[model samples]
Target: MVPRRRGRRPWHRSRAYRLARTAVLVTVLVTVVRCGHDMPHGGAARAGHAAAARPVPPPRPLPRSPATTLRVPSVDVDAPVVGVRLDSAHQLRTPPLDKPQLVGWYQDGPTPGETGTAIAVGHRDSRTGPAVFAALAQVPRGSRIEAGRADGRTAVYTVDRVRVFDRDDFPDKEVYGPSRRPELRILTCGGLYNRRTGYTSNVVVFAHLTATR
Candidate 1:
């Protein structure tokens, strides 16, 4: 009667164990495929995205130029410029009365298109009559000025203001001060005429560089 008992199967050969093994094999295969995709090409794609997201740098600025000619359309001032040195009084030398049509540029200071105040002085009038810059005061605000440079380029400017300061209170620092960008100082005799003291005031035109050609 101890009879008929059936033997149990091993765990490795059971139907549930076989299904688990199949599931594990499928999961391992899927993981291997996912890892392969994420390794080489995915890394390259991230690098490409990073490079595309980078910003481009700006271009460099042009070099400075020396002024040769000056033109102001508003006042009809189109004149050739000549370089002159400082006088014994440590002042900018004036153009000869005989050549009142010429404009004098301060040679020791910044050039026309350089990064500082460029001083240009002219005779407002001569003993005979009107001079080159005689009508400079008539130039309105927001006028345009063009200065030809030695580098075969023209520097364009816009007149910001025109001022007449008495010789006793001339703002030398403002007119000839150091600047971060190219500036222009157009100067001439102005205000009341004094037989003993000459011109009682100085006319100054302030202009800033706006364009270059």
Candidate 2:
């Protein structure tokens, strides 16, 4: 007699498949909750109080010249810095992959070493592996950052603190706020990686413009 074969169940109806689907859904929900909604700089009550406080200091003068290069000996990042306009496709213009250590400056904002936070960004790694800013995570408070301007001047800054924030929770005002003293904010991705979400957090190093040479 000939033997007959049994039919297999569809994937959607399988117990293992159903459990996996449920787990994935749960994970996504949890991630969303953890990320949370964007909160304004302050609530109405705090806004009123802040307004009553002393006025914010004026922004520092833009150099009679703008910077053209950025170098950080401690992190071994030395690359030409380009002006990144607000409307530019990318805020910061980075160097070619060959020079992965290079970072770009947001031209729309304060120049590095100027009052009001100056923003600079670099990659933590490339397809090959550790890239410029790769050692950024290891940078401690008090490290020096230097920027060379085309007008024959250089601005130096000293690290103040390193902070990590979820990408969704990026505190724009705090990072870009005006300051009486010149400041710098170096940023890069950090934290756990999710195959579906990429990087879960950002690492920011805050530095104060301590001197110019």
Candidate 3:
């Protein structure tokens, strides 16, 4: 009945139009947030989260070769290696007492330069006298140890630690367990000598390969 408004359309002034405009704006905001484009910090947060989820690389595996010799300059050891297998009792046999200077390596296990644990056994003392590893107990951490392989390669290692375990409390898994890197265990009878029962304990040197040639 009244004259029409000067120039604006009637729909433009309606509540429905205002509500539609507001809804459109809300939808745009939701999309931005969901896409990680909401603001200045959103992109950076996504990048940081992606970095945190990245995977770590696994350790590199070492080469496998039969050991031919062992040298420990600190202990003045330059011994020949011999392959030894487990006995019927499932025990590592001692190197022959006649060859007290000989070192025994487990033939079925990882070689000295291999990725897994490698074991070298020698006698702390022989019936005759002190043996190749008689001075093994005196070898300290951080000392250098080297093993020459049959392939003419050399594996150089650093002593990490030395441990003595009683015969009754020996940790089989710790000494012979699998490892991610090349490892060496120099083992021998230790602790007090028991004429009736043999040695009362075992000496173990834990070392890890640091170089190869």
The whole-model lDDT of each prediction reads: 0.59, 0.55, 0.63
Tens-digit lDDT track for model 1 on 88-196?
4333355676677888776666666666666777777765678888888888889889888788988777889998876555554565556667778887766665443
Clashing pairs in 1: none
Tens digits of lDDT, candidate 3, 106-213: 766777677767778776665467788888888989999999999898888889999877655555556655676778888776666533334456678999888777
Give lDDT tens digits, candidate 2, residues 165-205. 76566665565555666777776666665543455566778
Strongest candidate by lDDT: 3
Model 1: residues with Cα > 4 Å off, grouped in runs: 1-64
Which of 1 and 3 is the better model by TM-score?
Answer: 3
**How many Å off is the CA of 146 in candidate 3?**
0.3
Name the lDDT of candidate 2.
0.55
Clash number for each model? 0, 0, 0
Name the TM-score of candidate 1. Answer: 0.68
Q: List the residue pairs that clash in candidate 2.
A: none
Using TM-score as the measure, name the better of candidate 1 and candidate 2: 1
- RMSD to the hidden true structure, all candidates: 40.1, 16.3, 33.7
